[model samples]
Target: MAIAIAADELESLFDALPDVVFFVKDAAGRYTHANLTLVRRLGLKRREQVIGHGVAELFPAHMGGSYAAQDRRVLGGETIDDQLEVHIFPNRAPGWCLTRKHPLRVRGKVRGVVGISRDLGRPDARDPTYERLRRVIDHLQQHYADNVRMAKLAELAGVSLAQLERHFRNVFQITPQQALIRLRIEAAMHALGTEGSIADVGVACGFADQSAFARQFKATVGMTPSAYRRMTSTKE
Candidate 1:
């Protein structure tokens, strides 16, 4: 079922979301609202410029127009959940957006279509080595809590460990263990800063013991988890 929200309320909620979000109406095919991140990404000086602007307005004159018609189809009670598209953004470099289109209903009736997108920009990934390393890195980034073995990483990268190590160092300039440690430390840091729990933070980042986590965290960030929390708290 479509989420029950008045247009204004939904706009506020959508704008509050951390991801870049915006919506378009079927009738006029203009932007209804764009979140702060989306606004900055589009390089608009002011919010007024974003609203009432269409993709054709923001993108270069040579961009595609088929999506506008597709948006209209979604508003007519068809749901286009997630579609991947590559387009050029403000810097004239290629970028990716995981585009989601859903029907926006008013009073249980289809009012318009709303689109949400998450950007994924990785130009270096076109190279073979980088792409292989990226697939491995993505698993670690997204599933840090899961047990990730060296064999699994090599398998995902479609190479042997020696090859993986050589290519990973060449592309990312970091060893696999270093990458894992950095990822674990960053996850711990985020958990420590945001949520107040020592053990939870330890386990979330695949750390078995608080002492080990504290040691590595201190080594990587020059501060313990508790100290990091204190730092963030002081800044707050």
Candidate 2:
């Protein structure tokens, strides 16, 4: 059954969260409703300014175009979950976030998209599972370039795969695999700033090959590795 709450209520509720950008987009991928955080990050003073605009209109050309493609996938009924992304918005801290988008359905028919991009927060160190997961996290940080295995992580956590997944999510807000990918991508991003070849950077970051690295890098960073290199170079 569809929830009875209205979109406006959801928008208002999300507005209290300054670290989350929340929105509802119509079938055409135009924003129908947005929270204050999203409006402000877009460099707008009012929600009305963001409404009726698509990502292609709100972000830079490259980033907006990539986001528009992602919207199309969600509008086609794909649910994007815990996708790590980099955001460089006006009047906001530049950092990585986890984004999720789900297709909104009405009467069993696809209607629109509802989503949120939340800034990555610190881990819950007070959680009982934190100590157990810390071992796994440390191993990843030390050997992110290696082909890390999930079974090894589960063993280190002293839990079954299912329990490890649950505990990791509770503490980190992302799956262990997602955590590993983030580590590798961050390493790659830093490596790209140097004089290293793009292929070498990909291999050094544990990706299977240059193509795989480029694909994942673009999806997460909203630009290709070469383009990212050029952007950084221009800023230098």
Candidate 3:
């Protein structure tokens, strides 16, 4: 005979999974139910505080905007399968996660969204291939101010250029070159918080010139370096 779990038992199971965050939100994007993982990650003392709030009320503006958009997509009867994403915790830490969201249907009509996010631990510690990939990542992080060649990265990983690219895509869903750019941009962002000239920050981050840095930074971060610095400055 098949076994069936009761509703309360199913909820208890969700609460027991510490590494996974589970939540249900109404079509209007208000939280209806949230598991203990979500509650703790949001730094809430009780679940009741999260029951009626939306993402915008809890997360940083940019991250909250992204979540709100995804909620709209799910409510429109779309299912978002496991996708890698960067999530910001209430403690202001950011990490990679696998996120999935599906529409909650009532009488054949989409009524809300149900979602889960599981943290993906440090890339280096995950698998053998990932350990090799980590070597390349560490090298890039240390030498981001230098012109990093793909061949050098591949050689470090003991793989061909093509194999290195495939591994990066499989693990991070981004190419090695893209990862390099992301690293450079992140470094530049941190440097911008200091009292350095924009041109200096650009060059320090390995861009060929200030214009090139500006273009790439704007493309990747959705704002000019100067603007980002000013915005973050105000917050601080």
Winner by lDDT? 2
| Tens digits of per-residue lDDT for model 2, 25-50 | 98889998899999988888998898
What is the C-alpha lDDT profile of model 1 across 34-79, one tens digit per residue? 6666676677777678787776787443342456556667767788
Best by TM-score: 2
Which structure is stronger by lDDT: 2 or 3?
A: 2
Whichever of 1 and 3 has more TM-score, that candidate is 3
Candidate 3 clash total? 0
Candidate 2, residue 187: Cα displacement in angstroms equals 0.9
Q: List the residue pairs that clash in candidate 2.
A: none
- Compare candidates 1 and 2 on lDDT and give the better one: 2
The lDDT for every candidate, in the order shown, is 0.67, 0.89, 0.78
Off by over 4 Å in 1: 1-126
State every prediction's TM-score relative to the real structure.
0.46, 0.91, 0.64
lDDT order of candidates, top first: 2, 3, 1
lDDT for residue 47 in candidate 2, whole number 0-100? 87
Instruction: Give the 10-residue window scoring lowest on summed lDDT in candidate 3.
Output: 1-10
* Cα TM-score of candidate 3: 0.64
